[model samples]
Target: MTETVFQEESEVESLLSPLRSFLKCSTPKEWVEEAKKEKNLPTLLRDHLICELKAAQSAMLLIRRYAVDEESGKALLNWLKPYEDFTYRLVGDWRKLADYSSFNKRMVPKSRRPYSQPLIDKMVLLIKEELHHFYQVLEIAEELGIKYDKITSSRYARSLLSHVRTYEPAALIDKLICGAYIEARSCERFAAVAPHLTAKLSTFYYSLLRSEARHYQDYLALAREISDNDISERIAYFGEIEKELIQSSDDDFKFHSGLPC
Candidate 1:
């Protein structure tokens, strides 16, 4: 296990190299110490599972609103039903969650735009990956005897969403930038906490770094492609907000919450 772990870490170093350069911020060390405690593992897992499902759902929203035809929209709904029912309704157990898989990739009409297809394709990939991650998290939680529980959301995402512009194209651009920051921060946090976890959990977290890294890049790329003006200012503004959210005091020790108070 020791030798295998070393090789895995070595392989991910190339992935992490660019990850370090992509973000303007880091996860606070205080949060890491709080997250690494044995008592907090269950809370972390529960929050993470919610985060994964939310990521997939958010992507689904983007595709349905801007890209999919009516039939494809219905298909997307069917795809999400089992995952949502399990997470929100408590209608299914861990075994059922583990069994649920696959998302229909059928192409249909998109809200007309030159960049529409690229947006649809990237978001579909992200949604599929995020949902798969949700299942993986559930499996890990089951193995650790951690049951899913409803959690009040952290201010992290809402704060960012609250700042989104209220106009067309601009609104969409801001949303994509927000998505990028969220994915980048999640990747950063996973790397931050991995070393402090049990070897098994650590391996899982590190394994996520690559996909998370790419998700952020995909979002940023789309944002750039769709925008008519320079978005660097907006990105900088949100980066500052995201950094504050990460560094601020919070009573909750959620997966993406601020410094534990």
Candidate 2:
């Protein structure tokens, strides 16, 4: 291989190293093999589109619930309305979604919490990028003649979130750590499946590595920032749960699904 190609591969490994260490296990080979099949491409892409929107929505919720005032919360909702309409209500032109990705409202923090601004800043940028990725996935789906159909969400996220503590900052911190695991797994699986896909698709998945890597870090950093005490124990606690979710048997075979049963 040329030096340029070798360098790119090295860079991708460097980016993924921390994510691999953060999670307890890599995605099973069985899952990757299933995901890369031609017959599974539509399901894969459809689920991916929803996953992107969900990621954006998750970040939006963090901001609206913990940081933004009433008006800014409304603005955040408006920013995502078109995408939600298209995805859930099936009521808008997906092609026009780019218009809605921009958020211009000044977000007034709800309180003097030191973590609020960092949370808002990181999550807002994450929301915009995820929504843009949603659009990119849609474009690829359209090119491949993959129609948008509502697919059931994988149990992955809900299951991880099921373990969240039902309290104040602890609840938020757990959710953030769950978010980190989710993002990290997504990045790991993207690299795992990229090589088996078409050149265009492989390149597209590779293109997402940097931003996805940053996203998990952002979630982890925010979690650490919000916690008064060390969060290492909590991070390890969730890591084992996330690892089981990835390595266990599952009948469903969406992007983040476990080994096919």
**What TM-score would every model get versus the actual structure?**
0.93, 0.98
* Clash count list over all predictions: 0, 0
Candidate 1 lDDT, tens digit per residue, 161-203? 9999999889889999999988988988898999999888888
- Model 2 C-alpha lDDT per residue in residues 1-74, reported as the tens digit of each score: 99999999999999999889888998888998898789999999999999999999999999999997899999
Give each model's whole-structure lDDT. Answer: 0.85, 0.93
TM-score of 1: 0.93
- Model 2: worst 10 consecutive residues (lDDT sum): 97-106
Identify the leading candidate in terms of lDDT: 2
Model 1 per-residue lDDT at 27:
83
